[model samples]
Target: MSVLDTRCVNQLYLTLSNILSISESDLRQYVIDKKFELLDIAWSEIDIDEFFKTVKSNVNRLKGNIIESVTISHLSSRLEYECNKENIYNLYSALTGETKLRKYLSDVGIECIHESDVISVFFHGERIDWKQYEQTPVVLMLQKRLGVTSSGDKCINGFLFSGDIHKNMNVTHIARIPEFLENLLRILKVHEAIYFWERNAQPYEIIFKEKFSGIIYDGDDSLSLEDKNIKTIKHCISFLGRNLFNEWNQNDNPIIRLKDDNDVLADQIISSRNLKTNRIIFK
Candidate 1:
């Protein structure tokens, strides 16, 4: 079990955040515009003072309406019990003042273990090595952080750090989106529907039974237009209708990485037994 300390929680959050290619600074701007929020932490990152002030004005009166005001003796027990209950994270978010995110994380069943010294996260699925792949985005960032070659079928990566080497860059396989378009594939039941997206090229057709299509463009389609992305993705999913969007929103994101209880990255550590290492290593 991992503790909910600064390093662990932030690492976990970053690993799972969907805007893989986007940097934290860029994402923060979206937070400023209230396009989407990162619950509480995003506000802290941009301006700690302003965030606290906002919270004080909007939240102070609810001091007694939350778990924070409860007696300390029952805090630990209550938290543990809630953590064990299904979607009890809703309670945690209510306490933390971030209900939507709490609902989201709860659906995924990812939880932190601050109650024990080992301080770890637990998942319902035990098959993949999630912890290892969780940090791949950081590695992806490294390739851009410093100049590195990414020729051949390899991608330049920089997630691993050595006590001697600030970063260890390598050309490796990008994790193949651990889970396939399972949710979208479910849409296969209705073949008449087209796909849709807010960005990127999307497949116009499915492989008959394979379910869910990819970007439909051949060697010559634009993959970065906001409207085009939406159209392309819409082509891939038009069969499901608007409620499907909520399904996408409500669908619990399963573990898309390898999960190892012992691995930690700050000490320049990594688990070599991940999906990318075994099957996706470019060279």
Candidate 2:
């Protein structure tokens, strides 16, 4: 009745068709074209007997071997077939716009789908390209996160794997994606190594570096002769370093760099409170 219910019913149809060796697209079209015949059957009032009788005829006529013999005396016996009667009913509901099959599945608390089981019966571990779904939002999200542009990337069907980089930004926004990824992986690896190396390592949190800046010092040559000018120069240099550190940490993007002997940012100075850790870490 609702949009979500409609979508679930559609997915239920597709998954069932893949299970039963039927064409979901053809079945959907058949139901749409022959709505008059299906509407008179009172699909909402379907019992086990009514469902079996209605589906047995269609299955026998459409594909012949799909149901074999539907002279089912018991629901338990119906499960003995290569394709169970309940799944056949799910396919039927998908074809005829009925909700009873989905309702029956929900009532029995058996809604989870085991992908391994489906693949064993239908695909046997062969890769299915499903090229039609390339335009879907789910695929696009994976592309953005994993830096997948085409199908041939090292990603496992667009899934992010180790050594993958988040290259969604342009070269202007993020220069050298490969180098960025290399440094990112190195930083994460170092964090992981340190975590395992320590006996009391807690879970590490991520820290992102957004921007970088530096303060410029300008003074008259006449003023350089005084101790006050020299002190001011030292203080200004310290202030510039502090400003640059703050600017980098103000962003949500992860900063990639090698650590020094103290596991610090090498040349940068930042407070522990900003990263919430004595050492910088990444996920």
Candidate 3:
């Protein structure tokens, strides 16, 4: 009895098509097959609108299934050599064009503040409060300006302005493409570490904690990584990765330690209890 937003379905179709490089007919056939196999229903039984409503309701799960299928079919190496530090940065550079990363981010309405080893990113301009307007138009315009057509390119413009992917809500802090990509790549690395740990049959919590001791900590004595959930730990890792990317260039060793300033900013953003006080906080 609930109405579904057709636009969400359309965008998901386009996104999957772009990501998989499949034609519309092929995608349609694939969906039909999937529905038959999973739901045990003929495609003719349901109206197209109802089918799209189902997809909209389960978009995240569908996306995950597709990604897992792709990974199983093609990415045998997984994150080992493919997702190395160099390769990730190269992909970032390629998406951002020839201009420097900071400059490209600034051009697309992101403000970067560099203080010592820390680099803080925020949404800039007069309209600091983005909660008032609808987010789809804002996201579409920003994506056009940033030339974000490929799924390979990180497109977090919606979440940058609005707090969530549905683009119906707002947040105090927001991050554009760079931070989104950084967080994604860092999570990939964490997955790599998890794979390694699992394959080696290593002890669970203690050794895993040792591997990421200093990198995940934000210099806050009270807030400990050991006490945090996997999601929070991944976020902290991405924060560290972003700071490291800003401070060190391609030629530097990728395993450098986080400096004092980086820890200070991390403490302010991640450890600070204030989450909903709108005013350009970290994403």
Candidate 4:
């Protein structure tokens, strides 16, 4: 007979206990009964010690295959309860010591700022803050991009929704928002590029001012200047797609001041590429 890993069994038992809101003592019996029912066998048909050993062995097997573990499935099933699969997956990750959001960010040289109401990141000497909005177009775009629950308030429970893990599992407390972190990294790269252009291009101010002043200066006269402006605009548009830039020309947009004045020029520029530009920015 193989030795049982009591640690793994205890961890799994604790996890199931917390998730099901049942005491560990009662949970053990419930699991045994559930397993007996699943196997279509009476408790008297199997020796109790042997059955428990089998249960511990099954828990050991769940170390690397938690999501698909039959024991987890059995424990999670309830007549009136619907399981949250994502939460279970996160719990499994926590148990297995998987890399989570904060650690992942630190590994890639991005620092997470712990704030009360917003998700903030410090990258390339810039601190960017993302505020949560229920189901606005920007929030919808982010949720869709991140594969969070769309079409309802369920999205608010996703990691991307609050830039952290679901609030339920306070035991492990690991923050696992991989998709949001990756998206933020991409946006930060583009943001850094735009900032580089802003610092290096002497014509940036002229182009920006002229672009919004109703004075059309197509970069056809200065190819280099035109290229830089177009790249800057593209980056801004990309930010808009990520909701890092405000789509409604709101004054609170972190990036740039976009108003009615630049609407036509911005539209023409974006339209040339068959792309749509919302009132997003370059601050």
Ranking by lDDT: 4, 3, 2, 1
In model 1, what lDDT does residue 42 have?
23
The C-alpha stretches of model 2 lying farther than 4 A from their native spots are 1-126, 132-134, 141-248, 252-283
lDDT of model 2, residue 241? 29
lDDT of 4 by residue, 128-223 (tens): 434443455555454443334432111111110111111224311112212333245555554453333234322101011122212222222232
Ranking by TM-score: 4, 3, 2, 1
Which ranges in model 4 have alpha carbons more than 4 Å from their true place?
Answer: 1-100, 129-177, 190-283
Per-residue C-alpha lDDT of model 1 across residues 85-196, encoded as one tens digit per residue: 1221212122123443333323455333322222223444432233344345543332222122131111111111111111112111112110111121122221121121
Instruction: Give the TM-score (vs. native) of candidate 3.
Output: 0.17
| lDDT score, candidate 3, position 116 | 32
Query: How would you encode candidate 2's per-residue C-alpha lDDT over 33-95 as one tens digit per residue?
Result: 434434433322223233224333233223312321100100101111121112222222221
The Cα RMSD of model 3 versus the native structure comes to 22.6
The most accurate candidate by TM-score is 4
Clashing pairs in 2: none
lDDT score for residue 269 of model 4? 19
Model 3 C-alpha lDDT per residue in residues 149-215, reported as the tens digit of each score: 2233321111100111211222111212233433322322334433332243211000000112323
- Enumerate clash totals for all models, in the order shown: 32, 0, 1, 1
